[model samples]
Target: MRLAIYEIREGDEPHRLAHRLLGDFRRWTELVELNRLDPPYIANDPAPYRARGLRVLGPGDRLLYPYAGAVEPVGEEDAEAETYGRDLLLQRGELALMGGTVAMVRGLENLRGALERRLRTRLGELPAHPDTYGHLLHQYVGRAGGEAELRYILLEAERVIRQDPRVAGVRLEGELLDGEHVRVLAYVEPIPPGSPFPVEVVL
Candidate 1:
């Protein structure tokens, strides 16, 4: 397989990118191996590898991939039947791999991913629209706060989630995972076209 350059996009994930450009998400290993990336979140080892933390590839990041193929074809059911939205499937910051390829999600799950990501981002983190792109929940992290602060976090999370046109309504709840972390559960009611769903985001 010949090598090709893949300029990562905002939503690009290794497995998903592999599937889109290499005909199989499983080929993400080829990306790591070719790029000589060390202990990416997908590494299968113990201790030190786990301690190194995940490598986040943002927009403009370039990766070398082999077998640059056309984007994977949509499944017959999805193409001929309902047009469920398509997106990369991720779990705990890593791509969910199947048979060496990345897994894919559709429809409501796509919305869930969007909600999770929005809540995890800190307000003003995006340079293009520094004033409007992220959430304030990150500010409360690793600091002392009481009921009022928690309530504010919830409100902020709800506001951020509702920004997605897909979300019709949202109910938020939170728990102190520990002194340094918080987990927010958002039960989102999608627009009339889809069913309601819950998304968990830890910060």
Candidate 2:
């Protein structure tokens, strides 16, 4: 995947950088998570002031943003292929073995597996993937209680699921479970107008 590297100039914060680059101030969290930056974004201060939640940009501080590229046209043979995407099948977070070899998942199952993985991954945790590829649902783990928070969780879950190209759209509802875990119930509308399937993701 191609990415845009943004240099942090003097007096730049997450919101300002996001607005200047992504054109949306609301996407500041995406900036912060993409750069794996914590609060009090001090330059080189070992002891940053913790009372205020302000960000300070340092020299040579830069951010990375995923850039969209032109999609390659699919051939007739590829279009007729059965699977949306393919990968080694994972059952219960472990490789599913078949005849002493790793089994593979294809078609709708592969798509489901991919969606689940994307939803469960914490943002900035996977170095191989674009920093914005995963969900930020973990942030609400211990703080979700009120109706507004629940609604935000559901919306964020839907946003993350919809990022998958295989998923045309998604309807999500958030349920708070014991141990401060949030469960996202999703009804995924796949590309090519297939029947919507139910998926559950716990974060």
Candidate 3:
């Protein structure tokens, strides 16, 4: 999946707020590591690097902001002022990363079957219908307590439309809402007649 990294600035600094709000330092670090971010270069004494307008982030362009000692997601609009406790800064230290967009699919049900099969081996008995999508399943990994077992099940429903020879393109639309939640909607169109949607299954 494509990932983009945006550094937290003034309004975006969730780390600072986390400490002020939660007063938990260890939890904040855990959030950072979970998102695959490098260990933070924070300090009690502000220096040039702290003043500099760049911060390195991890995979998927996701950053964690410390809120009451717990790391949380910070949106683009809130990044600037959240960086520092002052006026919003225009140019600040930030970085980004991107990934492949060519996703493969055959059909919704086919994709659902594939996901169910794959996850069953890994997570054991998964919860049915965790969210709005009828095809999705949820499983909690990691530990029994804490944020260890939080995992979302995604049905790669776009595969069916994409694999069809008659279909020119397939787009999966969705939103990555707060709290790492995702909602997907499928859209498909035919390429030409005679050459209908492919019936063959790849998996």
Q: Which candidate comes out best when scored by TM-score?
A: 2
lDDT (Cα, tens digit) per residue for candidate 1, span 1-203: 33344555555666887788778888888766555455542322212332233332334434555543455654544432122246788897689998899998776667678678778777666675454445777667667776666777787777677545345578889887777787889888865346677898777
State the weakest 10-residue window (summed lDDT) of model 2: 46-55
Deviation from truth (RMSD, Å), model 2: 10.3
Q: After superposition, how far is residue 202 of candidate 3 from its true place, in Å?
A: 23
Order the candidate numbers by TM-score, best to worst: 2, 1, 3
The TM-scores of all predictions, comma-separated, are: 0.53, 0.58, 0.19
Task: Give per-residue CA lDDT, model 2, range 52-124, as digits (tens).
Answer: 3233334333355544546565554343223254579999889999999999876667778888987888766
lDDT of 2 at 194: 46
* lDDT for 117 (candidate 3): 36
Report the C-alpha lDDT of model 3 over 1-203, residue by residue, as the tens digit: 11222333334334653464346544566444434233353322212222232232312122433333344665543332233222111111122222433322232333333322332322222233121111212332222432222222213334323222223444445444334444444444432211222222111
Order the candidates by lDDT, highest first — what do you get? 2, 1, 3
Q: Whose lDDT is greatest here?
A: 2
Candidate 3 regions with alpha-carbon error over 4 angstroms: 1-7, 10-17, 20-23, 41-55, 58-203
CA shift of 118, model 3, Å: 29
